[model samples]
Target: MTKKVLITGFTGQVGSQLADFLLDQTDYEVVGMMRWQEPMDNLYDLTGRINNKERVSVFYADLNDFSAIARMLEEVRPDFIYHLAAQSYPKTSFNIPIETLQTNIIGTANLLEGIRQLKEKNGFDPVVHVCSSSEVYGRAKPGEVLNEDTKFHGASPYSISKIGTDYLGQFYGEAYGIKTFVTRMGTHSGPKRSDVFFESTVAKQIALIEAGFQEPIIKVGNLSSVRTFQDARDAVRAYYLLSQESYKGNVPCGETFNIAGEDAYKLPEVIDLLLSFSSRHDIKVETDSERLRPIDADYQMFDNTKIKSFIDWEPEIPTSKMFKDLLDHWRDEIKKGKVPLNR
Candidate 1:
């Protein structure tokens, strides 16, 4: 019998990509939980991404509703559960702190609590993978790389929420005996990423410049802060492998791992790489004070040793290729006249 994996945030970048990759490469079946009011338009390029569409199922339930989500988990009894849903914008969190806390913190607690209750009744516990962000390691000393051992110092509401969620995963594992794996994801991006992410923001601007749709100037935020970028596809692979392993594998319950590439670059350098990839050198970057984070993290990177040793996963895609892929996505959309010049 094929194993069943219950995944939330089915429409998100990592969740969507993971669903496709697993359906194509593994015998496990994926049942996605989405909060859509009406059935979302069948995922675009569905057949191209997933080999076994027949094995996929979707449930409609709000993440805020514990009872509904609990009932779904009891009915499904998935062998693996991947919680990838959250409100994940750092800058936007300043304006919507309540919503961010409610979704990232409370929503996660609900899942953990629900799973704990279900495990007690069913006598079977599903291994869970909780996707977390590197932002939890806020304000690292200059030139220091973060790892599973890195102490957390949250600087913003968004980071605080993630920190709470990360600890919540541990609480579930230690206090309730639910096997849980936590991943501190770096800056993962791809073609379908939303514009809120810095990579996509830069790529879209380059696309506009290349198409002669806008001025040769791109507005940006703090350029001095450094971050390690990883491909979403690769990140998802690490997550999948982690979830499949035994509870006592290298990364056991309550353990955390960082998923990031080897190279660390500043925001300006990332923007430059994107421009160079597009072969558009004339563009100039302008620093906009409005774009700066209210509580900016000065330095950030992650050591992948723990996760790499445990799952034999590493960041294989080069930074240039990641940027190029995103550039191509925006360029394709421009060719189709989908996005406007003023956008």
Candidate 2:
């Protein structure tokens, strides 16, 4: 018997990588739910690599519409649901706070309601793994390590929305007897990350400079802020492990796990690392006021003991290797003419 797994935000970095991981499995059928308006280029690239279209399916639906979500849930009846859809960028949320709230909060409620309806109608409950963020912790005290029980003090509109959705998942699980596990992830990055993100932007700029397509100037924001970042590949693997633990009844419903990286790195340190991979050593780093956040945390870290003990998961990708892979990915994109060098 094949178990059907549904992944929302299928076109995003983590979701797409998760799909890649699942495509290698034999007994799980993967269904990706994405908005109709989203471009299909990433999906195309993903499916092209998998080669077996029969094992994976893409469903076009909006999370805001409960009816559509319910219908899709009824049709797929997925054994597991990884909810990753959201307005994910923190800085952009400052400009579109309302839209972020609608997409992240209401969107989460609709998905959970759809699962509840399915459970009521057919007594079918899927193990839902909700992707939350460490940003919900807001400004951690200097040198303090945040854990699952840490109080949320969301610093940005995006984090606030994530906080709402995070608790919503818990509420649905505890109140309605639905199976929900929230994974509060740290800053995970790798290949295919949007250029708007700090690390990707740096890597992209370096790649462009290396290709002689752009000038040797890198624009940056708060270089002193520190964050723990995991590789997207490693983070998705942990998500899969948590889902499996839920399915095996090893992880309790409504439990939240903090997926933290091995160490925290300052923004300047990361930028320096990317510079080391570049061909041009004379490249200038310019601080852009527009790129800086209105409110930024000085330090953020996560304590991953719970996840480690429960799933035996730890990040295997080193920081140097992660940045190298990101730079390599950008270089490939540049060579393929997919990335526009002019900013």
Candidate 3:
């Protein structure tokens, strides 16, 4: 019997990559729930490569609508659910705080409620993997290495929303006997990363400069802040591994894990790494006030001992290698005229 897997936010960075990964697995049927308003460019290539159409399906559903989510859950009856949908941009969340709360918090509640109803009706409980952010750690102390045991001190509206979402997963799992696991993801970058993100924005600018479509100037913000970057592929693989554990009863429900990179890098170091791969030698970096976040953390790193002991998971892609892939992807997009050079 082929297991059915439903992934929300299927068109976003990590969700799209996970969909592609599961499509290659013959034993799973991938069902993607996406907002109708979002663009489908990310899944365009994956849609073409799918040889077994019956094994994959895309459904239109809004996370904010409980009825819509419940109907979809009943229809799919997925054996595994990966909830990755949300207003994920942290800076943007500041501008649309209300929308962020509704989507991240209320939206999560609807999904969990829908799953509970499905469990009662069908006597089937799917293993659910909820994607949380490392931002939930807020301002880490001077030399603190964050782990699952660390207390959450969400600094921004975005992190606060995630704090609620993360705990909701735990609440549903413990109170309702639902299989739920929350993953606190660090800054993961690679191909298909949104252009608005810091790393992707820099890579896109460099690609445009190299293609002679733009000037040799890279706009940046908060270069001194440090972050641990993981590859999106690696992060998604961790999601899959955790879900498998939950499904096989190897791991306890309501547990949380931190999926982060092995090494940390300052924002300036990341920019320098991208510049090293660029063919443009005249590129100049300039600090942009508009790009700066209202409240930024000086340093954020994770201790992955918990996840490492649970599964045979480790980040294989180095930061330099990941940056190279991102640059190449942006270059191809620019050369093909898929991405505009001007704002």
Against the true structure, what is each candidate's TM-score?
A: 0.93, 0.96, 0.97
- Candidate 1 per-residue lDDT, tens place, 205-304, comes to 8898888887889878878888888888888888888887744455567677788877788887888778778676678888878778888887887788
- Give each prediction's root-mean-square deviation over alpha carbons: 2.4, 1.5, 1.5
Each candidate's number of clashing pairs is 0, 0, 0
> Using alpha carbons, what is the TM-score of model 1?
0.93
Name the regions of candidate 1 deviating beyond 4 angstroms.
37-42, 47-53, 247-250, 340-343
Error of 1 at 207 (Å): 1.0
State residue 3's C-alpha deviation in candidate 1, in Å. Answer: 0.9
lDDT of 2 by residue, 1-343 (tens): 8899999999998888898889875468899999878966556666664466778888889999998999899899999999999999999999999999999999999999889887998898899998888889887888888899989988999999999999998999899988899988888888878787889989998998888877889888888888988899999999999888898988887899899788778888899888988768889999988888887766888888999888878899997888899899999988888866343
User: Per-residue lDDT for 1-343 in model 3, tens only?
Assistant: 8889999999998999998788765469888899878888788776754445757778899999899999999889899999999999888888999999899999999999999888888786999998888989998986799999899987788999999999999899999989999999999999989887889999999988888877899988778778889899989888888888898997777889999998788888888899999767899999988888888766788999999888999999887889999999899888777865342
Span of ten consecutive residues with least summed lDDT in model 3? 46-55
Decreasing lDDT order of the candidates: 3, 2, 1
lDDT-superior candidate, 1 or 2: 2
In model 3, residue pairs whose N, Cα or C atoms come closer than 3 Å (at least 3 residues apart or on different chains), thus clashing, are none
The TM-score, computed over Cα atoms with residue i paired to residue i, of candidate 3 is: 0.97
C-alpha lDDT score of every prediction, in listed order: 0.82, 0.87, 0.88
